[model samples]
Target: MKKATRLLTPALGVGLVFGAMGVSAQSETVTVESGDTYWGIAQGFDGVTTEDLVEANEYNPRAIPIGAEIKIPDGETSSDNDVVTHVIQPGNTLTNIAAVYDGVTVDDLFRLNPGIDPYSLTVGSEIVVVDYNSEFGEDYLYHTVQPGNTFNEIASVYDGVTVDDLLEANPNEDPYELTIGSRIVIPLN
Candidate 1:
């Protein structure tokens, strides 16, 4: 029987290991640069979220040290076909841009472009918007609030999800004042 062996290359910041069964695992890492945020790093990878990086690294997302290496989890490779970008024009607002695109909302724009200030739209700057109807992954589902939808009504659509679960997953949202077209996270059971 063969024993598991692990190897890490400091220069490349990659970790590779092979188990007794000859199964191998590799993790890619990125060095933290100045002015980097978890949300900003997550944007470079497809199907990865700020939550995913936080959970994987177990670090304070707000206080990531400069020069620290961050492990990149296994995720889908980013493809240009999966993203749609729009250049900002004078007097353009996220609300109006969303209105021009089918199935896009202000919340979606905000979510896609983190650290964006709605009040400071820069002309010629690009922003991303995604199709809400497209599946992100099995980890969670994105649901847009409708005009007359409640937490209870949303919970009823998914099996084994309660209003409490919804509240817990979305700490920043106001249950009683859900805005129409706002997106919420629906945790999977």
Candidate 2:
């Protein structure tokens, strides 16, 4: 019976690894800092909801000693160069602002402007539109497309732009009929 139990222990552990729990079997260790709780640390990671954290803890909940290493999902690395400042317009809503920029969501805008209430659009307040790593150009108002340019290509030249975002900006113009020297509205970062 002792021999059987010993063999079952490793198998049970492996079974837990492959269980219904959504946590990755391969996890990286994060050190618990002062005032860091499992809930707070878990919330920091994307794709990790509260339930996932609870499930992950079931494996070794008691092991999370203060200053102990705990497994956490990966987090995004912030780039100082990616910051783009934009002045809030009178008619602008948080969602509309997010739609104007590529790779950005309303939640992202809210996160960047911590003190600004989402419900209240404070005109003239500068907000970071997109998180990227690129420099801004001097020509702020517009950009004219040159020959051999696609929506994707144009987006690549500017910071915080995507093909879809460019298309959204120019509702009247056809994406297929992008002519050279045609002016397109560049969304302010």
Among the numbered candidates, top TM-score falls to 1
Instruction: List candidate 2 stretches off by more than 4 Å.
Output: 1-81, 133-189
Q: Best candidate, lDDT-wise? A: 1
Query: Measured by TM-score, how close is model 2 to the native structure?
Result: 0.29
> What's the lDDT for all of these models?
0.67, 0.55
lDDT of 2 by residue, 80-107 (tens): 3235555677877887666554345777
Model 1 bad stretches (over 4 Å): 1-86, 89-122, 129-136
Candidate 2, poorest ten consecutive residues by summed lDDT = 1-10
| Cα misplacement distance, residue 126 of candidate 1 (Å) | 1.2
**RMSD (Å) of each candidate, 1 decimal:** 16.9, 18.4
lDDT of 1 by residue, 120-188 (tens): 999988888664334445667877677688899999999999999899866656788775545677988
Error of 1 at 172 (Å): 3.3
